[model samples]
Target: MALQRVLAVDDEPFNLEIIEEILEDLDFELRTAASGPECLDMLEEFNPQVILLDVSMPKMNGYEVCRAIKSNPDTSHIVVMFVSARGSVEERMEGYSVGAEDYIVKPFGQGELTAKLLKLGHMLLEKDILEQQVEDATTTAFSAMATSSEMGQIVNYIENIANIDDVTTLAKALINCMSNFGLSCNIEFRINDEQFHHATSGMCSPIVLELFEILKSKGRLHEFTSRILVNFDYISVLVLNMPEGDSEKHGRIRDHICFIVSVTEQQLLAILTRNELCQQQQNLNGAIAMISSKFKGLMLLLDNNRKQNEAVFKGLQEQFEQRIPTMGLDEDQELFIYNKVDNAIQKSVAREEALIQVRAAFSEIESDLTALSNKVDEK
Candidate 1:
């Protein structure tokens, strides 16, 4: 929808008059309130997409009024921008703490207010789209992690998380735990810069993921009316409907959710560690196979070299014996030559013996590697 409807709440009539003059020619259908209480009284009748709330008003300050508006499920979705003279970081931060979406200091330009409202108007439209998408998600069919004692259910989850071998199962278990407490939640489990999300309304919507990014940094617990967000380091769970109008139940639910998310974070960490180890084991096994194959190739090369040496030396010795007497040497000279030739052949035989020993050493080392691989598997 266009940025048409707006309610400007300020005690000073002059300030309200200035807002009127600025917006007189603009497209905004503006209304003014003299006090915080009056602004709230007009909220339902005006039903504005935006509320330009004054920071300092008699009886009700902007923060308190904004808190009231935000705490109410009916008006929580309306965008609130604090209009105040003080635009310090501290002032803006205070506004945000009360769930104000934007701020405008005193003496803001017509262009500045218009631009900010337009920007927030676009935000509201986007929020509507996201909400619709969330509504459209398939509802999850899951058996709640049922138990009478909330602590007992948590204990069961702690025990069951270990058995959840994958991200999907872990997400489901967490969702089931939330369902047991009568809370509908969307959860994100992040590790190693990867995100795994689940919703009680089926797979997590992109909108829910967007919310995870937006509210995850707003401390451990962020509440906007009935919606509760419990954020931890690696896990964020957004409860869709925290029981409204029940302070005690709300407090208990928040505590339960906080603990559950904490536990889920630990479990997610463990799952990541296990996955990393399994991958490492797989890589190690591949490396071992390659090394073993190379070792066998080296052994084969050694055997081939030994055979070639034997063949070459045997051929030379046979030729030497056959051609020796043709030189017309004496029998004694021939004997001397025979002994020398025998000694030289002995050298080749000794080399072969040394090669056989090297092969035996390679075999021993290969066996050792195999044993080590087995031990790794056992461990």
Candidate 2:
């Protein structure tokens, strides 16, 4: 370690000698100044860590010198200890008020002087270490906050884009999200053999595009150069211009990108599936409507045929009653003819009941089809 620099300023030559002797055994580079003016002159080049100041001087006293040192930005950090013959409590308080770290009485023991200097040196070292730790902690906290903010934005954007049913619009939204983080990105989505692509600029390099395909097959996150590529089931996102030399920040960005891509892929797939199901439902509804129309036509034809058969049977019954009575048949023959006519009418009634049952069954079928069509429409 480098030696700690110490400047001892005392107007008395004998006092300076005594201070030099007291601190000689310590690991310090000592510079002595006979007056406050001389000390101020040496401070620029000496840049001592500690200043041993004497209060009683001819023109410029140690109190004035201490205040001057404290006021100057360049020399304010140096520790100033008052070494004076004036040892009263009032003198000590005055010394402290003037920015002195400690006040030592004149005729002090070698042990006391050495102990005070060593303690101040240790304090200075601890102060430096503590300041460094605080600085480092502050830096880490800011970094974490920044990463968290970026991730939050990514999640919110994914949610918003999920509501968009169009693949092209979703692709554009993804691009905008990446742009918000100051990243250049190229995205591609392959849904049902349809290709959709969006890029930050006009076009991405061929190498990057090829890598997007390769990474998509891998279905994971990959990093190369200043770019990171994340892949999902049917989508690939290429994030470019990532920061270098900061491993922590890079990892944060990579994780965020992967999560965003994964969620977006799921949403896109759901939209595509829903669209396909809707189309199939439409086709099914059309087929059902056509069958219903055909059944309705068949029902009309059956009604017409039933009415014509009834009219023919009635005519036959009228012909039997009129013609048989005119031929002078016996009573038994007339009764047998009436029985045959009644049997013909009963057979016609049975056929008409069977046709009505068939028509009722067709009507139930049509109701079921209509209900199914309604259910599909609701979906």
On TM-score, the candidate that comes out on top is: 2
- Clash pairs, model 2 backbone: none
C-alpha lDDT of residue 311 in model 2: 96
What is the Cα-based lDDT of residue 225 in candidate 1?
85
Instruction: Put down candidate 2 lDDT per residue, 226-272, tens digits, no spaces.
Output: 97887777898888899789888777777777777777888888788
| Candidate 2 runs further than 4 Å off | 1-3, 11-14, 33-46, 56-61, 72-75, 158-162, 202-207, 318-345, 373-379
**TM-score for each model:** 0.57, 0.84
Candidates in order have lDDT scores of 0.85, 0.86
TM-score of 1: 0.57
